[model samples]
Target: MENSISVVEGRTLHEISLQRKLWADLTAASLDFCEDLLQWSSCGNVAVTDTDLDRVVDRVLYMYVSEPLAYWLTGWFALACMNLLLQGKRDIEVFVFGAGPVAEAAILSLDHGAAHRILCVSVLSRHGISNQMLAAKLASKVHFKLDAVKDRTRLHRAGFVITATDAGAPLFEPHEISRNAVTLSLGIDDMPAEYFEMLFSQGGLAVGDDLVAMEARNVDPLSLYYSRRGLKLTEHGRADGVKNYSEILSDATLMERLKNWKGPASFLPVGLASLDVAVAAKIYEMLSITLSTKE
Candidate 1:
């Protein structure tokens, strides 16, 4: 598709070309970022000190946000493209409920998977900065009109509903949705038990960080963000005074178990894959490892 000039930040054709090239580089860079994360996480021989961990994470974010020198405009564009692809569902309609980085990430991931042109719905304050951006972005991509769901009627016959909103209460009651409909809660797992009960009783998917609740309701509480050191699942259900990744993982074995287990109620970590340069580099390293193992 010819790049839409309306959203293009440049005035002249040369400027536009420069912008496109920058964006292309951002996409490639994200791939490289992912690869760096995988290498640091998988490398056993390297001494993983606390200082090293700090540096690793900082480096990853620097690359992620394109901090000092590079602008993140291209990363955002590639992500936007991904969002369009996911909501391109044809056979069945998909609805999006939340409006943040994770929700946005999920939408982009869906696009990468070439989902059917799914209908998307999101909840936002009519005025919040994040919400407003989400609304505009969704408008740019999705064809359907954006409707504000004042009450429960918003759950109209959607095949799959993704709750990306940070609604403090149970977003939907158990019996409200169709039994066949899939409900993915892309929110923090520290919600009240009532939410889990509602989802479990009705048979739905809840994504969060609470392993205990996740186990109880058979929900999947997995986080997919990658850093140079390792993958990050927020420390939501853990105690204070935690030292390192080892401590976090050791104490959170139950959480890890919840992630590894396969069942309706269990949570699974669906690692986000980027075709960005950083991720590509990481994959190249992984391929090298696989080859070396074979040799």
Candidate 2:
């Protein structure tokens, strides 16, 4: 009766708990699948779509299966960026800029050890605590520290930051960012304009899923100028130029650039059709096996 009781909307209390577990497992799976895909010798090219996935319907799923997956893909890309930024580095201090599974997934994907302390900074009130507890519960080797946004000092020590704040203003000051920091930023507004100013003043690297398509679409700070409203058809800064993430991984040059890149760099990995398809396919495959064995 307890599991059957409807709490909110159409979901029962049972479904809500299942959703949390699914979020964590799916996060881990997405990261592993992407990493394996990168190393697959037969893999050739990746295609991406900006379209939302909504064909499947479930009372419990809500928008989780829809196009919002684009947002989670941004966090998955954080793995590639972190590896490049902190190569051969030990005792890495990872600071995640958002508290949800999407941001925590970045921490979950990282190399686990005694020395790694992941400082997960969140803006959510109670929801933030819920996510962190689930993450800390699931985290065996890695330590997940939940810190509020008001305690912004944690950002200063982050070597690899996975940010999914999707914020409209600076969560932390520009000076707080660690030198030569690399972040997987979900959008242009994830950090303050002043931060970008500082990055561009020195030298910063920027990458994406498909930069040319993004340039044509006029999304993200990669575009020279953009409007806050009025069709975003007019909406859109920093770094020498924006390169595609896949291409960077495919070649050693850009990874090398990221290795030696100075100042603070950010990555925008959302809106890629490739990522959505990959994640969807991976989740389906994994879930099917999990459901089949009743594990």
Candidate 3:
């Protein structure tokens, strides 16, 4: 009977295959959890292999099928907005009209070259820093000021406006802004349904940035990355041998996305104490993608 099968290294080939399949199932489950966390679904494919499992134990390290796609879409839209404003004979004055997390993230991400000048206008209700303080911190390059209520005559003449506020209602009244101004709303969901009715009624260009949907896409990369390292849980105390970040992020498209992205982004194995190991793996993944391009 097949029951006579002998075990090698304390396990049989069938056991190894079964383990791999179970690991795959675990990977799928983890991806479901992350999808729940991100509130979205995969926009790209996730590939799992033994190599990916060697490095992560009881953890998922996600990678993106096309990590740069979102950024590309965002950058292109931003450039298009800039071009629209420039063509309308408006000076490149980027007005930030709210104080929120996404707004703060954009402020943190902005480099001097992205926009000629940035003006952060806020109401007294919002507390972060006065526009003046922001200008001082930004080396006197970015202009910051209090949000005026009596009249927005200054904003009406501006070239660009970004409503980065979390306000549930419209920030600017339709027909209240410059006809040539390019407007973007980042923090709101279903922006068109919510605020664009008035903007459209007034003939203003309204763009929506759905970051939550973007987060949902490609969340499974973590699972594939972790599974490649041979580090998932089992009867053993803890399986060893995990791949570095480089092994994960080095995918061709991912590296391209990181070319100008100086922000903090990485993949870490669960149950890891030190970030050093995870960071090392991330770098390795980035390099791997870069090297593949040359080949």
Candidate 4:
């Protein structure tokens, strides 16, 4: 596979080589694409995949291909990369909250981190053994220094932070995140409730790859709050505070709004189907090109 397929960013996941264009495509998708996905029958160019019992696909524009797991991870990685796409390149500190089996996603992020000019990295694993393993796996792939430290300040100072742990409680405070930090919590338990509230509060911004997915799962506090609030004029359901990643991609000023935001920003890539569909489409294209070349 390494000989035939191009490797994606990061020392791991050699089966996938994510082209930068995928980042641009993920962003370029508009609200219409989302609407199309929802409406189903009217969806012309866009593709839709649903796990729900009310599944809808009137006409298939594309078939799902590429390894499902690889494309899904790629899609999820793209969702987590809203900050990189919006803000462009910058030197950043990288922090990983859990480095056990969940370490792969954080490791996948290193490719983007390298592009962003990572200054240093600090990781906290389930037992610290995974920390060393993560560092060792990365030693040959990245040039930047990775220090396994329990320092809480690493989370505070990190320009890029990821939480792969589920400790049954929120891991960090809203203030603990730097004013402009980009954090990606793989699941719900990685972040505090206040951090979700911060998305509605001043200076903070909230972004998600797939609205249906974000709204469906309890990815974090916001998803749960959104579920319970549901069209109500509740104080927590501040419509103006949220922006879809596709909407931002179509509008530079919108992306800039989050990039220049004065508070902590997070990207919750929760939906399984959309990320899988978006990424699978792109990966299929890439692999098709490779196969055709061989023929």
TM-score of every candidate relative to the true structure: 0.39, 0.59, 0.37, 0.64
Candidate 4, 50-163: lDDT as tens digits: 322222566443354323243225323532464444355457777778765444445544553343466777888766687887777767665677777755767877877777
Better of 1 and 4 by lDDT: 4
Model 2 ranges off by over 4 Å: 1-31, 34-72, 111-135, 138-150, 216-239, 260-262, 282-295
Residues 48-109 of candidate 1 have per-residue lDDT tens digits of: 12221233543632222222111121223223322221222344444555556555554544
Error at 221, model 1, angstroms: 6.9
Model 3 Cα lDDT, one tens digit per residue, 231-262: 22121111222123222222455445433332
Best by lDDT: 4
Give per-residue CA lDDT, model 2, range 1-295, as digits (tens): 5655776543345544554453454456565655554343323233332223344565222112332244335545565566555554555566665665555445444533222533443333234565456455445634555444434556677766665555544455678878677766654555655666666666676666554455555545444322333222112221344445544555666667655555667776546454455566665554445455764
If ranked by lDDT, best first, what sequence of candidates would result?
Answer: 4, 2, 1, 3
Tell me each candidate's RMSD, in Å, in order. 19.2, 15.4, 19.2, 13.9
Clashes of each: 31, 7, 40, 2
